[model samples]
Target: MYRILIVDDEPMIRKGLQKLVEQSELPIESLRTAENGVVALQRIKEERPDFVFTDIRMPKMDGLELCQHVAEMDADIQVVVISGYGDFEYAQKCVSYGVKEYLLKPVSVKGFKGVLEKLIRTKSKVSSESFIAVTLLEQWASRMEQAVWMLQDAELDLVLDEIQEELKTKHFKLNRVVDMLAEINTLLEQRLNARDVYVMQRDFDLAGAENEEAVWACFTAAIHGYLEELKAKRKGKLKDPVEEAKLYIESHLAEEVSLEEVADHIGLNPSYFSQLFKQSTQETFVQYRTRRRMEKAKKLLQQPQWRITDISGEVGYADHPHFTKTFKKYEGCLPSEYRQQMGIRA
Candidate 1:
């Protein structure tokens, strides 16, 4: 539901607009009114409405002045100016301020309805929920990003699971969450060195409330703080144990990386190492390793230069059929189809 603020000097006009908005059956969370620009500006700071509907002429501050104040505070809120004078000049000014529309005086119910319909048709702009969610996802992704340069199977899946749950709960917007995660990962990689890069993917998860927006913001902040902390500890170099394991995997991508081998390499018993891997990597060790292998397979198949057998060997798959099956499961397409779709040909 979008909150709307009506800023009109006339009591009757304010009441009329309020009534029309209510009658439209739009998702109106709140309908607030301000008699003048001063009062409107004060309300503007206190409340984040989705739109502001104002009269062109008024004492103290006119519609134009009120708009300027609101615009300075937040330009995203749709502004609809009410003008009884039908003055083209005033309408033009409103347009210049990025007003949604200029409504003529004695705003006819039909005309009001038409404009309202147009507004409803327009895509929704950013909302408070999104702003908060984006912030949290960014944090979570960034923390993982700092801990592992390459995403791992265990923890990455867990994070995705949590996000899916958030979406199911209707706490977060799916697209926004994914976008924020992508952005944070990209940003983290650009800022960190190889050590930090390799460490990030294994080290982050959602630590905030499951509420979509809150979770997103908290996750984002956690990563930011962790990165700063890592930088401080390593004298600007990445020193995470997770980074050590990831670098090992990169160097041995073509080699078999069993859970036992990875755990043993990190000096932990097999089961304990698996647990550590899940805690850090966010997925089971086997799952993460399989993803890493499939990812390489996908990249290799995209080249006209690499054969299925060669790519399979490179990704530590002894059998071509197994590689093909895994790639299909993870990427939702067979390697051949994926390559063709990407415009790659042998």
Candidate 2:
């Protein structure tokens, strides 16, 4: 069990840190909080937490002094500094006192979680190969997150190329590459609220990739395509009725969704909504819905646990035969056949 301390002048910051720590899956024995370094130092002496997350500036006994004191008292205690951009250089000086990581002000959840995961990996003494893999995964996840947010296509391509080069150097097996992709997806989902934004589907095949280079090329292409989709979605005009309607359709793919229902959901007339939807998406509402349903059905088919009948119902088909016909129309194969083709048990 790991004991932890959160020190900051702001009450809200302390509360936020406490909540994040409590919610984390890591094994935490106790969490202590303090408004300033003076209180934090006193609490540290009394409680002796294994880790300290502290702000650089405080009313009394700032973080630097507290770090020095903690270092003098016990070298085992790990310190993670939280500082504003202006104080970054000052925080860097705390490295000599053994500050483990530096988090900028207004910390992002991804960055916070990444730092904690890194610390946990360090304490557990993970194997060098595994450690390197984990570190690269986190770095790629972070860069991908930023690229998506900023809509930086060039940066995304650069990062993907860098990852490809590194994968070649490491000579990761196909299974290991697949596992890494899955882990990256998990991280992206956590950071991007992807569940609400888009449906993640395993619709690509990589079994033909026999070498590390081939595997990474296929993987990178898939990731690049997904990122481009996200970028396009983000580029859609803010508060665009067409985008909102698409979101409604995505969220209600399992339901008997109609143009009128979506129009009403977004406060638009049915005829007008139909026109705008077609104009914006370059497809009729029915066309878009069918494509989305087929895409979702394909995703569900990848899960071997879901039967064909269940998948039909999951994608809004009441009649199994109708689902099969529609899936074949869109995919040139039945759902089960598609699954089998992907080497997934049907």
Alpha-carbon lDDT, every model:
0.66, 0.76
Give the lDDT of residue 247 in candidate 2.
93
lDDT of 2 by residue, 90-172 (tens): 99989888787999988777778788877777755522554245777888888877786666767877887786677557654
- List, residue by residue over 1-346, the lDDT tens digit for candidate 1: 6778998887888889888988888777888999999888777655556678888888999888877766654234678888766565766676656786878888887888787766655635344434545666566555565343342435544564565566556443433454355466555555555554334332434321323554454444444344344443545544565556777777788888776676557543354355455667898767877877887777788788897778888988787798888888899998788888988863
> Could you tell me every candidate's TM-score relative to the true structure?
0.40, 0.36
By TM-score, who's the top model here? 1
Error of 1 at 220 (Å): 10
The positional error of residue 158 in candidate 2, measured at the CA in angstroms, is: 65
Pairs that collide in candidate 2 are none
Candidate RMSDs in order: 16.4, 20.3
Model 1 regions lying over 4 Å from their true place: 125-346
Residue-pair clashes per candidate: 32, 0
> Evaluated with lDDT, which candidate comes out highest?
2
Measured with C-alpha atoms, the lDDT of residue 223 in candidate 1 is: 42
